[model samples]
Target: MPARERNHPLRLLTGALASSRPWTFLRSSQIGHRIRHSLSAKLAVAITLAALVLLLVFGIIVASQLRSSMFETRKDAILADASLRFSSAQSVFSSSTATSPDQVQESARGALASLKASAAGAGATNVALLRSEGSTASLRINQIEDEQMRGLITPQMREAVAQGGAQWQSVGIRASDSDKVSPGILVGTQVQLPRAGTHELYILYSLAADQRQVDVVLRVLVLSALPIIVTLPIGVFALLHRLLLPVRLTVSAATKAAEGDLDVRVEVHGADEMAALGRAFNAMTSSLQDTISRYDELAKLQQRFVSDVSHELRTPLTTIRMAEDIVWDNREDLPAHARRSAELLHDQTERMEQMLADLLEISRYDAASALLDAEERDLRPIVTRVVEACAELAQRQGVPVEVVAPARAAAEIDERRIERVIRNLVVNAIEHADGTRVTITVATSATDVACRVRDRGVGMTQEVADHVFDRFYRADTARARTTGGTGLGLAIATEDVAIHGGRLQAYGEPGKGASFLMTLPKHAGDEIASWPLALWEDE
Candidate 1:
């Protein structure tokens, strides 16, 4: 599908919102150390938006106060101006000395006329009077002709007027002649007539002008706040961009260093703490590079010395071996002490020769000159031969060595290298076996071939098992060298097996003995992700 056809912003956004988008953020949080959002990005956005929200709220509050102030001011002015007019009306009705009911009715009519002449307009509204004390308890108003509106003076308004003070209320008022509704206020006061007792005079005013004035002020405030609200985020974006430059550069430098570019350094731009941090990071990388270089140089020198010494000693070692053999042959012709010395010389010479061979092999591996001549071969005969070769050593060490193999276990490998690995495993086990039984098990799986050498001797601890293949690393160092152990046999075997693209592993428990397992791929180029056999057997 075309990209345009595949993605619609609205479509994608709607689908995500309706389903998993919100939860995706939470899912990122659940994977600790892996956050979907950058901290600075999250903080910058949140703070900028928060500032906008606060500004909006402040504008709203200001608009509300302005509205309230306008309404109260208009209310006070209207009430005060209208109160003066109502005062005359109240005096005309309440202070009249008329005793006859007809005269009282006439006085009420005159007072109503005086109120209309004084205060009532489009800005202000109806003025009504309630007859609270007469045989005829009807309501009357000056401007409004509708009797329904004349009766609009509620019981609550009458009660308020009875309290002897003017009070106001906001209410909905509909003109009896028109269906138009308006917001209005009713100010009610108590007045007493000589013939009519406890009458209420209420002046109603519409709040349309007050409402208009408040709306104008609110619109102005909203308009004024808009520029500031918009400009704040841009300012935040600019500030964050400027402040985070060094952090971004530091991250980039760290990334390069992690990828093994030790020379990568962040540019220092300021004398601030961030610049100091960059300098410290550069110093750390420089120290690491120097340390690695020193170790590498030491390793090269060590391998070169081992290679040169082993090569130069081979000729003298061969001559010494020949001399020791001649001495062994003439041992019976010498004194008993001389005969024993010849035997010891032969044994030490043989041991030194084996050590030289192991050292030469180790140097070859370090120099990257060792290569595998892998070919498909059966492993059963190899295991059998190795067990046979180590049989004399096993017997001398008072250990019984056993071999378990199938008819054939075929794999593509360097047969000699595998044979040497088997021999090393067998010999190493015999040395550490301590008169216990040693077992060599050769097994084949569909994908690989494995050989395991096990001994029920003084078993090594787990810590020893981890570094047992390191050069000259012996779990029982004191006895190992005395027992003709070169210490590099396992290390050399490990390196040889790795060249065949196989794995050699050691597993042990303290006092339970150790097992060395070597596994090889059936085909040379095939790699192993998991072992074909368990690293350790079940107790």
Candidate 2:
């Protein structure tokens, strides 16, 4: 497709979809990560849940209190009405106009009916009159308007009413027309009739009206709470976002500062604590920027001094080399002591030249002027060459050196730098071998190649190992003398590997052994995921 044609909106959209197809999982994970990490979301959810719990508790208490109050008020009204009707019915039963058993029975039934009629509008009510023991059988009245409610008068209620006091019990009321039941109250008392006998009178009142009223109130409350429940969290979230805006800005500024943008500053708006925090953070970043600027200047000056000194010493060193060579060549004509002095002077001059070269190299690294001459080459030959070069030193130290490698191990690297690194590691191993064996292993993975040098000798402690690659650092100064080293070999090696984006690590334990592992990628800029050989293998 032409570039302009591919730039069309529809085409671009399609291309975007195609490109993003494989990243759907990544996008979902990112969303989940955001939700899990977002402070506002977490706080909002917590506050919402807490508010819901509190509202639930409050609704329960209100509903319970209303229900109790309704029941108590209904009970008082029922008791008052029952007492009035009971007194009127007793007067009717004791009337002199009805003397016979038939008349007494007739009067008893009429009195019960009158009581029911009098209490009609109060609420849904059931009336029952039953003869108790000691009543004349012929004159006994057993009357009940609702059969279901008559059974609700329990034996306990009847006995309590028979003991001369009115008794009421809460009960369930089932309608005759349906299977549904509602709550009710049953009141029972003894009623004495002239020429007849004592009878139990019971009145049952339905509380469905009170229940309906309570339901309406609960519904209102629930409806009222719904909006609050919905809006409270939103309000809280808005407040939190507003309150935390300064903190968010501060965090963003701190993040930029951490990423080396020390000029980044938080904006201060008010005289509150958040504003104070912003001011403090700005002051800290400014101080850090100044400190870093000063340190950078000092580092540049140090590098320049080292470079100048190395270059300045080179001229004098060259003159000394030329003069010493002439003396060394004619030392045979002098006395034995003079000959010995000439040899020592020549050796010292050579050592000085080597030290100066190392210093110049270090300066290049410090100035970041070092270049990589990387090429595709086999590493087996490189390791073998380094081992062969260290053979004389290994023999003198009474240490046996061995090379373990495959036939071919390849990587893209600066062969010169790699050779120098391997040579230093081998020489260091030989000097510290303490009459033990020094082994070099070369191995390769799909992406990387590695070389490891192991010496079973007087190993270093953790503290010494940590400083092994620092310039002029020596585990023991006596060891450097034995090998005539400048003490910058490992430091240079470290820089070499770092420039190639590879790793060089040293491991050691006191009196055990020391190992140095160098791992490099096969392709430039490729990351090395795994090493081919273990740096420290358990014995």
For this target, which candidate reaches the highest lDDT against the unseen true structure? 2
lDDT of 1 by residue, 395-513 (tens): 78899887778547799999888999988888888877788888888777778888899988888888998899998887764564335667798898999889888899998877778
Write model 2 residue lDDT over 349-388, tens digit each, in one string. 9889889989999999998899999899998888888878
Weakest lDDT window of 10 consecutive positions for candidate 1: 1-10
- The number of the candidate with the highest TM-score is 2
Whole-model lDDT per candidate: 0.73, 0.80
Candidate 1 ranges with C-alpha deviation above 4 Å? 1-40, 60-68, 71-75, 78-82, 85-89, 92-162, 169-187, 191-196, 199-220, 281-284, 393-409, 430-446, 454-458, 476-482
Query: TM-scores of the models, in the given order?
Result: 0.74, 0.86
For every model shown, the clashing-pair count is: 1, 0
RMSD of each: 11.0, 14.7
Displacement of residue 254 (Cα, Å) in model 1 is: 3.2
Instruction: Give every collision pair in model 1.
Output: 459-513
